[model samples]
Target: MFVVSAPSGAGKTSLCRELIDSIPDLRQSISFTTRNIRDGEQDGVDYFFTQTDSFQRMIAEQLLAEYAEVHGNYYGTSLETLNTAEAEGVDLLLDIDCQGAAQLKKNYRRGVFIFILPPDFAELKKRLYNRGTDHEDVIQRRLENAEQELLQAPWYDYLVINDDFQSAKKKLMAIITAERCRMSRTTYLLNNFTVKGDK
Candidate 1:
């Protein structure tokens, strides 16, 4: 499992999409949320949109691997989905915030955690304002939250800077590739390649 956390407007979603599409045997874990489905978002596709009451019920029943409330909305990952992916030996990509990533690390120590950052604070703010969906007050709040989130970047296994979309994407792909070829994960292949020289 790989947990990716980034502040809003950091290009985390776009990077995750490219990573999942390029890597074999890797898929993004769709999270269930009680938040309203945004424009052009499809339920069960973008997210498993549910009511607050039902989301609370899932939490109470202990069906979620990790969950957190942010901005008055409940978001969580289903244990069943994650476990199934692990059983199939597929890498699970989690696009969550720092709060949820921290909680997940407590339980899933083997999971890889990656933090994505924007090129600079100026660019980050520009992207946020360009979105134009939030009011001035809301944008200010988000900026404050983003500053806090950036502080937690040192806690992640890797820090990726989105200076350029393509360059950042390649760097992320390299991280995943290197992880897949780690000694602990690919020991079987290493062992098979250790035979005495015949040629």
Candidate 2:
């Protein structure tokens, strides 16, 4: 499992999208959201859009592995989704906010956690405006929230500075591949060979 978090407009989602396309074995765990779908987003592909009441029911039923309220809307990752992926021996990439990431970190200590950052605040502001997806006031709010979000980056296991899209994507893929080859995860390979009698 891998968990990724970044402030609004930091390109984490775009990076994760590319990573999914490049890695066939990895799957994105689509989150459930109470927010309205954006222009290019699909129902289940982008998010499982649901009513606030329905999201509340999920919270009450303890069906979500981790959830948080951001910009007045609720977003959650279902426990069922995580369990199913694990049962099938699949890798899952979770795109979530800091709050959800914190909860996941505590519960899934072994999962790789990464934080993405823009080259600087000015670039982040430029990207947000260029995207043209939010109002000026909303962008301001996100900028304010981003300051706080950046403070949470140090605790993450890896930090990917997204100065260039392709470089960042390559680094992200490298992180996943490196983690898969960690000694702890690969020590079982030693069991395949018997010790030779060298005297």
Candidate 3:
């Protein structure tokens, strides 16, 4: 499992998309959210949009692995989805905020935690403004929240700075490739090898 968190306008979604497209046997985990579906987002693809009652019920039933309220909307990862991925021996990529990432650190400690940071505050502010998706007030709030999120980068297993799009994508891909080769992650390969190191 891989958990990636970043501040707004850090290009995390774009990086994840590129990584998943190039890597086979890797799947992005679509989260469950109470927020309304945005333009160009599919229900099961981007997020499982749900009402507050259903989301609360899911929480009450202990169906979520990790959950958090961000920007007044609830978002969560389902335990069922994680179990399915594990059973099928498929890797998972999670694109979430720092709040949800912190919850994942405690509930899903085995995942590769990656933090994506903007190159600098000036660039970050520029990206946020150019995106024009949020209001000025909301953008300011996001900037403030981003400052706090960046401070949490030290707790992650890996940190990637998004200075250039292609370079950052390559770094993200490298992290995934290296992680897949870890002794703990590739234990199944040991089953095919003898004690003498012969297959």
Please give the TM-score that candidate 1 achieves against the real structure: 0.94
Local accuracy of candidate 2 as per-residue lDDT tens digits, 1-199: 8999998889998899999999867999999999999999999999999999999999999999999998789999999999999999889999998899999999886789999989999999999999998999999999999999988898899999999999999999999999999998889898867755673
89 in model 3: Cα distance from truth in Å? 0.9
What TM-score, computed on C-alpha atoms, does each candidate reach?
0.94, 0.94, 0.94
Give me the candidate number with maximum TM-score: 2
Clashes of 2: 0
lDDT of 1 at 136: 89
Strongest candidate by lDDT: 2
lDDT of 1 by residue, 1-199 (tens): 8899988888999999999989999999999999999999999888999999999999999999999999899999999989999999899999998888998999886889999989889998999999998898988988999999988889899999998999999999998999988888877886767786886
The TM-score of candidate 2 is 0.94
Which residue pairs show collisions in model 2? none
* Local distance difference test values of all predictions, in order: 0.91, 0.93, 0.91
- lDDT for 71 in candidate 1 is 89
Q: Which ranges of candidate 3 are over 4 A from the true structure? A: 195-199
Q: Candidate 2, 84: how far from true, in Å?
A: 0.9
Write the residue-wise lDDT of candidate 3 on 86-194 in tens digits. Answer: 9998899999878778888887668899999888999999999999788999899989999899888898999999999999999888998999899987898987666
